[model samples]
Target: MKNMEPRIFFKSSRNVAADTGLSKVSLRAGVGAFSLMEMMITVAIIGTLAALCMPAWTKIKDNSMRARDVSNLRGQAMAVLAYAGEHDGVLPGRINRGVAIPSTVTTDSKRTYYLSTVLIDAGYCSKDDKIWKTVCGYGADQFGVAYVVNSGKSSVPTYFFGNRSSTAGATTYDPKRIVSLKSNLDPDKDPKGKDEEPLSQIWMITNADGENYNSSTTGGLSNSLSEDVRTPWGGRHYVYFDAHVEFKRSGEYPSVN
Candidate 1:
């Protein structure tokens, strides 16, 4: 070492450091470039995390949508109840089992009281696209909530519907209860209510057959409830005869009487 020149020693040391730095650089480069297995593991971890989060995220979204729907129905229920109160407790539109007749507002022409004419038009409820248009996903004629009547139950007789345009206007139960609208209701005459109730109906029946209980479509009376459509997110919504609202799942529908 003493025989070694200082300049040569310094040069050797510098070369050693450069080589060491190059080696370190090579090591770091190799470390920075992940192997296929490493990449796969990272991907798997991300995928697992995503899968874990998806259900929760989906639940939150569904809950949010359901809440909005329930709120809409509640408002609609209130309006229907109010309308009934003013008309001596008559609900607009008449529904037996399969038969649905629009409430007759004018006797001259039989202007069946549809949702728009009976409630929205009469200023009982408002149907802004923001409320039920986009949310309900139906056109003006077939948008908003539904109005159904009783078809009777094993325990109760066929009850009456409050038809505002009814000739029995302002008369409580004046219009004789049609037998067709009863426990063994004529499926053809009963246009709206499903099989669970003795009286009254749901706010909106899911996205049913675009017919009776298709609360999404509020304007026309042209079709029937889809045999398959019930509440989509979970169940349907009801604002019953008692002015109470509840979310019900399919097959476990609450009593609307």
Candidate 2:
């Protein structure tokens, strides 16, 4: 038997070269590979698209938080009105931690009475309520509520009830001296009980930062912001005495009489 030439079944160099060329063509036409520049361009496009979407996403997130804040405030407003209805239309916020009945309870005898304290103690709202917090206001942990209850400086029918006590057990809270939402600040000057202003015009609550509420001025009703005023999109939410809510930008406070 003629020494069987080692039966070589392998393809020739020419055939191999042709097969390799066909494979390359198939790859280029079927699953093409990206060059370095093409890959970089794709990545860059993706990054630019993401950058373009960021602002809209941020705006959506902010608006959602704002809506939640508005809802929370509206609920609190209802709670306040309910408390007032029960208390003969008298607003809450007398004692920080006790029945608001006329008492000689002084500051030394109890925690500093906050305007929100009465609402919490009277079951109008819980201390843990989200309404007590704000997106652009100080945390509830800092104060009883994120919104300023009122200036609370004057009792001459200025607005909101004032803390008559200096410290714990330092003074008496006379029940008869209590004022309600309908109390006329200028009854002598204006015989009309309307006080020459509508309830809608009277702002009852707002983001402490928007109002630049200071603890020194508000007697700790809110924590002071000495730095830049932080608001949601340079705007803040307001809750009126009529339980109406509104969003106004900085320097856009309603022209209230």
Candidate 3:
């Protein structure tokens, strides 16, 4: 029997050189290329993500504006307090029945502020009339007087408080007797009535008409109260008796404690 043996074959240099054209390095490097469909799909996905995020971004911007309005209201409140302090504790009177009195501070953009008072004297009302009625559609009358400040001919009014109105036959509020101050930057416009409440009467109790920033009324100081109506910016700036100024949203009056 012939002996069987395994033999290995190795190529010579000339043989290797002849096979070099068949090497796959170029093809391997080119494997990473993306097809047109793949590229298009990736772009579409990114665009969709951007669209989904836009609405939320807009909402955040709106909230920021609302917060700024509140801040301006607070500032006006502080300004009024400072004015009162320097004037012997006597609050400033309105220009007319419903008009705000201009401040001595020239820095206030020539806007006028309102002042009113509530008297706590006796013989005003009978014991039964002692119970106060709610004013301006805001629940029960907790505060006696509401001093209103008109920042400008914008929307909404800045309001301040004393306590509640006295009963009939009693001394009403006196703008000359302001002591301490509390303020609210209400977004609502002055309330309305056929015989619209006088600025003096409104100051006496919570008798402001509804915050009618959008109401259509004519004549008298009522026009001054309505000046803030239909604000193009959709809100108004107000300075409260406490020396705080705030921007209030239309139809949403702020209340201070």
Please provide TM-scores, in order, for all candidate models, with all chains considered together. 0.52, 0.65, 0.36
Clashes of 1: 16
lDDT of each: 0.46, 0.56, 0.36
The runs of at least 3 residues in candidate 1 whose Cα sits more than 4 Å from the true structure, single-residue gaps closed, are 1-38, 93-112, 130-222, 254-257
Report model 3's TM-score to 2 decimal places.
0.36
lDDT for each residue of candidate 3 in 1-257, tens digit (9 for 90 to 100): 99878674887655554677533555455577888999999999999998999889877766665455445334333434555566686544432222221222234422222231111111222222122221122321222212233322221222222212224673333344343222222334334222322232222211223243112321222223333323334544444333344555666544321
**Tens digit of lDDT per residue, candidate 2, span 1-257?**
76766776898755775877766566556557688999999999999999999999999998888888788677767877787778776766553311121122235434236545456656777665456666444333243335554323232254454445556776444322223344323345534344335667655656655244545444463234434446656766777778899998877864221
Q: Which candidate model has the greater lDDT, 2 or 3?
A: 2
Candidate 2 backbone collisions, by pair: 106-168, 106-169, 106-170, 107-167, 107-168, 107-169, 108-167, 108-168, 108-169, 109-168
Model 3 segments beyond 4 Å from truth?
Answer: 1-36, 96-211, 214-257
**Which candidate model has the greater TM-score, 1 or 2?**
2
Writing each residue's lDDT as its tens digit, candidate 1 over 1-257 gives: 36965554344544765877756667657668989999999999999999999999988877887778667656655775677677665555543322222332335233333443446556776534333322433331232233343322321233344233224443323222222233334444554455454335422222232333542332333444443443445455555554556766666654432
Best by lDDT: 2
- In candidate 2, how many Å is residue 81 off? 0.5
